[model samples]
Structures are given as C-alpha cells and as structure tokens.
Target: MHSVDHRFVELLPTPLERGVLYISGAHDIVAHLCLCGCGNEVVTPLGPAGWVLRYDGRVSLSPSIGNGALPCKSHYVIQGSRVHWLSKMTEDQHHRAQARDRDAVRGLNPTRLGRAKRLFTSLLRRGRV
Candidate 1:
C-alpha cells in the first residue's frame, strides 16, 4: 500500500471516503478509511489518551492504531501520511502496548492524567485495551 494522502478540513465529511484522510484540528478529529482495505471508517481523535497529530509538512499520527474489532483486525502506524503495517500482536503484547499508550498520554499531560486514566479504563472495560 502507498502512503495515505491527507487534506486538512474545517469539518470531516459525514461518511468518510477511502484512501483519503480528512483532518480537522478545529474538531480535533482525523477521519479516514481503514488502511488495510477493510473499507471501515477510522476516526482518531486528537487529544490526550487518543491520538497525537504531527505535521512536518505532512501529517503523522503517533502510537499507531490497532483495530481489534470485527473481521479486520489490522494493526499499523501512520507516520508522514504513510501506513506501516505491523505483524499481528499477541494478546499479552497488545495489553502491554495499550499500557504504553496510556502512559504516553499521561506523560504528555500530567494535568490530564485523570482523564487519560478514565479513557484507559473505559477501553479496558470494552476489551479494546
């Protein structure tokens, strides 16, 4: 697969389109289709405990995204608008990665630690962690 191109928009489209990433800093949302060709909509929020967006002329998302739900359990990192596929992680590895992501969020904003903790707990409850 090629690097997913992105466009910054004030608002994301109602139904996201495939092969395009619509970024909305105003809404703190980044919408795009699954890079694994699942045709599933992936919306990553820009915030602590969510996703961190970086733009060095091109957009990048930190900590990667792992879709463990449904038929497509794709795992990959989005950097420089490029999708770097990752080998499927074991259950223990997935749990460890979740902890690392939670820690990253807390480390980034100590003041929002509680909020990050809550988000982590919620994800854990949903078996998404």
Candidate 2:
C-alpha cells in the first residue's frame, strides 16, 4: 500500500511533489501526483457530486479516483492517507461508471424545482413514465 503526506493549502504549489496530497478548502479541490508513479497530476474537485474530503489527523477522500482517461488508467481509494489500489476497469465498465457519475451530478440540484425537472427528464429518457 502507498502512503501520501497531506497538506492543507490555500493554493496548490507550482510543481506538485510526488507522494503528497495538496488540499485547498478555499478552492474546493485536491491535487496530487498519480500514485502509480506515472508523474501525472490528478485533481479531485470537492463538492456534493464530487469527492468528499475528511480529516482527523489523517486525510481521507470518499469515492475512489479512477484515471481511465490517463495512460496508466490507475484506480485507487484514499483513506487515512493510505492508498488502496483497485483493479483496472474494462471499457464497458468505464462507460457505465461514467453514466452513473453523470446521473449523480444531475441529481444534485439544490432547488426542489430543479430536482423535479431532472427527475421528470430522466423518467422520460428511460421511458418509465
């Protein structure tokens, strides 16, 4: 298992260091290098529809980060500053995951009217109502 040093920052550093997770509450984002040593910058935005960050001495992020678009296609979860690697997803799995994410984001509308509209639209698309 890999480990990462967590830092709370107002803004990300010029060049992100490897093995470090830079979290910016001010910007609602987290940035770090790929844990697979791929030297790619992976950023996770914080929000209702995105990853959630928690801290109690050690940092944790809800929902795994899947870099399917990246060459390495790394997938992992961060909990208590420890990296737990996951198996690579197939192309079909990736497409389904993307669709689930889109639906999740669409359901996060703040207003009741907005949510109702989205629910109706989704039902229409599914031919369920």
Candidate 3:
C-alpha cells in the first residue's frame, strides 16, 4: 500500500487526489482513495448510526474499512494515519460480515433474534425477557 502523510483536509478535491484523507467536520465525512491502488473512492460518513471517528490529534476510525464491492476488493484499517493491511476474507466470512454490517446499518437489534428464541422457552423467566 502507498504511504500517506496523514493529512486531513476540510474539503475534498473535485477529482479526489491520492494519498490524502479528506475530512469535512461540517459534513461529518471522511474520504480517501483506495489504499490498494484500485483508485476507487472510499467514503466514511460520520454519525451515530454510521461511523464514529476518533481524532486525538490524529484520526482513527472505529471499524476497519473493507471494500467488498467489486474489482479490487481490499481491506485495511487506518489508525492515526497509518494503514494496516488485512488478509482477504473467505467467502463465508465475507458473507457473514456483510450481514452483520447490514444489520448494524439498519439499526436492527442483533440480539433480538436470539432473545426471541429463548423467550418462548421455560429457561427464560418472564422478568428476564
């Protein structure tokens, strides 16, 4: 992966330039080009329902970025402007991860399914449910 200077800009360029993490605090958005040199744009919108960015002088994203969408599928994490590459996920793992992300994005209670299953069983008390 190409190294970036770890600079965060307020406004993203018209045509995204490489090696920069453009951050817009007003928009609560962070964007950059694919570190794998795929040239695909990666956009992380910050919100309680979306992503939460931690910037202690430098920026660090909560969840790792995975480009599961087509062509060059790359995965990596940017911690304080440093990129850490991740191994490719197996098909099953990728599918599971995608499902989890979909649930999270949809604001569905992940525990609800399991909790509902136990709710009908005698093991779960009325007060516990």
Q: Write the per-residue lDDT of candidate 3 for residues 4-104, one digit (tens) a residue.
A: 55556765665777877777775556777888887878776665444678878777776777777636768778788688888754566668767876666
Q: Residue by residue across 6-121, what tens digits does model 1's lDDT show?
A: 88998666566777889877656687888888887776767865788999878789878877653577788988878889876556666776787667675675556665556447
lDDT of model number 1: 0.73
Compute the lDDT for candidate 3. Answer: 0.66
Better of 2 and 3 by lDDT: 2
Question: In terms of lDDT, which candidate is stronger, 1 or 3?
Answer: 1
Where does candidate 2 stray beyond 4 Å? 110-129
TM-score, predicted candidate 1 vs. hidden true structure: 0.69
RMSD of each: 4.9, 9.0, 12.7
Give one digit per residue, the lDDT tens place, for model 2 in 1-129.
388899899977868899999988876678898899998888776776668999999999988888787778888999999999998756776787789767777777567336445644753564423
Where's the lowest-lDDT run of ten residues in candidate 1? 120-129
Top-lDDT structure, candidate number: 2
